[model samples]
Target: MFDQNFIENPYPTYRALREAGSAHWNGDFLGGAWLLPRHADIAPVLRDARLSAQRSHCYSALLPEPVQPAFAEFNRVFGMWLLFQDAPEHTLLRKLMNKGFAPQVTDLWRDAITRTAHTLIDRLPAHGTVDYMGSFAHPFPALVICELMGVDARDQAEFIEWSDAIARFFGNPASSLEVAYRGRDSLLAMTRYFEAVVEQRRHAPGDDLISLLIRIEEDEEALNGEQVASQCSMLMFGGHETTRNLLGNGMLALLRHPDQMQALRDDRSRIPNAVREMLRYDSPVQYLTRIAAEDFEYAGAQIRRGQMVVPLIASGNRDETRHADADRFDIGRADTAHFAFGHGPHVCIGTRLALLEAEIAFDALLARCPHIAAVDTRPEWLANFGFRGLSTLRLDMQTQPADAGAVAA
Candidate 1:
């Protein structure tokens, strides 16, 4: 039996796990593997350098023996993406990717992304609502990454569809093999497509990231095509989909916490803090995984080597010890020391960029439409354990200026 309920909504179980500490539950409903829910217990394990992010750790004895083989390919290929890797390799790959994302470089995309946000919002029907995820959330990030990553604007919808399919491979164990298989195939196709794009850039490089990759691939760094493809895939997912969910998820938070939303409207200066609070309160990513090294002791229990360690980072933000009043949403709150971007050497590289896009996009929307509200619909959560974001959210609002409409009234 799978825990679909927990998958659909995990906060309650997370609370139980926290209160219960690191308890082993092979309950009738919950199947396979032990659970660790406490924020304190999970954090050190995630930050533990001894616990590796490699294949050996992933195939730990703590995991069901049958699962080991299934996760083999994932552990292997995923290493190229840098996010899953631990040290020098991680450092090198992140540095190369960061080369293109230099502070001055990402700043260049601000106007384009901001303009794209208004363009998407403008297309919404007058006095009605649209699926914020499909229209606004999904497209904003898609177009931003497309323009920045050198993908044609026409290909965004495909990226959105494929990324959604693959996102299910994360989080819970019940994710269908069909989802994983299809997602892998989709990634392969994209990689093949990127291969040609990278090749073209090799001969005729532009000022884009693809061009940057082409340049780096040739240098002594000698990053192979497969590695380039790996980074490309990371760029597509991390650059596009996560931002989509952040905007959508962040907006949903505002809807739920109108006080915070009102706080932004009351003062434009509060947008930055509000964005951080939104990320901390309910981040786009919820869980991260690691594998134990040698036998280690945690919370009076001996965690054997090769045991799979899952740290609930979202829960970590709500960690009472780390954050004061962990559950409440306070834009002005001072101790917002959240692990939302992750922690350690592998924290998200695009953190500053994500925060920038969120703040500017949210600011533009609130300024244009004063009386914004979520349409009557249930927001869908994505299918990944490592990400927390809305599948879709529809916002109902009126437009302005006749051309802009009369919505803000």
Candidate 2:
């Protein structure tokens, strides 16, 4: 079941698993983690204090003997990532990060997000097929986050490559030693780059997030250079990688359901809900790993201490108990409650920003290109199990007749 074909569309397998029980001991992946497949099971596990979010302990057991040494750098850097830390550490980091990541601060980027979306759309071919993922989805969020971080625009391409490598390290458990080394190298380079950024900000601060991290304080606690660099790297990864997938997956979902797409196009007010539905129907992050902080019984299974408990967020989103016609991609679905952005204390900090980007992106695409359809019905899916995204989404687009105010710059 851990094969590539299953990864492409694991819903059938998930449904079968869900029918069997809420949780199952799946020895196939993660060296035998307890797989939680239902909304009831997965939702509570997310908030369960007995589960540790620190995944390095779990990953260490999964690493092969030969790859163990090569995985050291990845473990060190990713260990510092906010997603992998638990308790007081996570609390402190989140509190400090929130100063600059507050909703109001993200709202300040709405105009910039809108402008970026339009600029990307403008560059799209007017009446020809184009790879949406390449032309728009991938770069839009990357550029936005880079601009927010005050990173050099000339290095945006390199940043994207580094981000992809790091994502592969986290999402692909079966990655070979060479792959792991590549991911570590990319992370090392990113760490050094951010370290310089942090040092520069320390001496000569600016208005970007890196500068904010350097100066932001919570009582006597403050982030050091390395912590700042790690946070910056985490933010850059989360800021773009998942959002890019959201745009691609959301667009593909709309294309698959034209009626719903037309409904959203006609009433832009529904774009927000549509985005929510898109997340629920096809979550960007498929699963999240949590270690058993202590031995505990959950969903009729005996979970031992230090064991990995993987909540299949994608499975939970599609559980029939959670939503009527859970499998259908209905943009107007009222129940948008989903584990897509995750749950509990570890929920995504950039949730609002990602949603705003998608809202603006879909609004712009639908408004500008009235006639757009997928070139291939079965679009290729990214191979990673944790992150669900399209590798390439080709769309044949036709521009709408120009309005009185619509004039090329």
Best by TM-score: 2
lDDT per residue as tens, model 2, 364-403: 7877888889999789988888888988999899765433
Specify the highest-lDDT model's number. 2
lDDT of 1 at 30: 17
Candidate 1 lDDT (Cα, whole model)? 0.69
Question: Any runs in candidate 1 off by more than 4 Å, and if so which?
Answer: 1-8, 22-36, 55-76, 217-219, 383-385, 401-409
- Per-residue lDDT for 125 in model 1? 71
Question: Which 10 successive residues of model 2 have the least lDDT summed?
Answer: 400-409
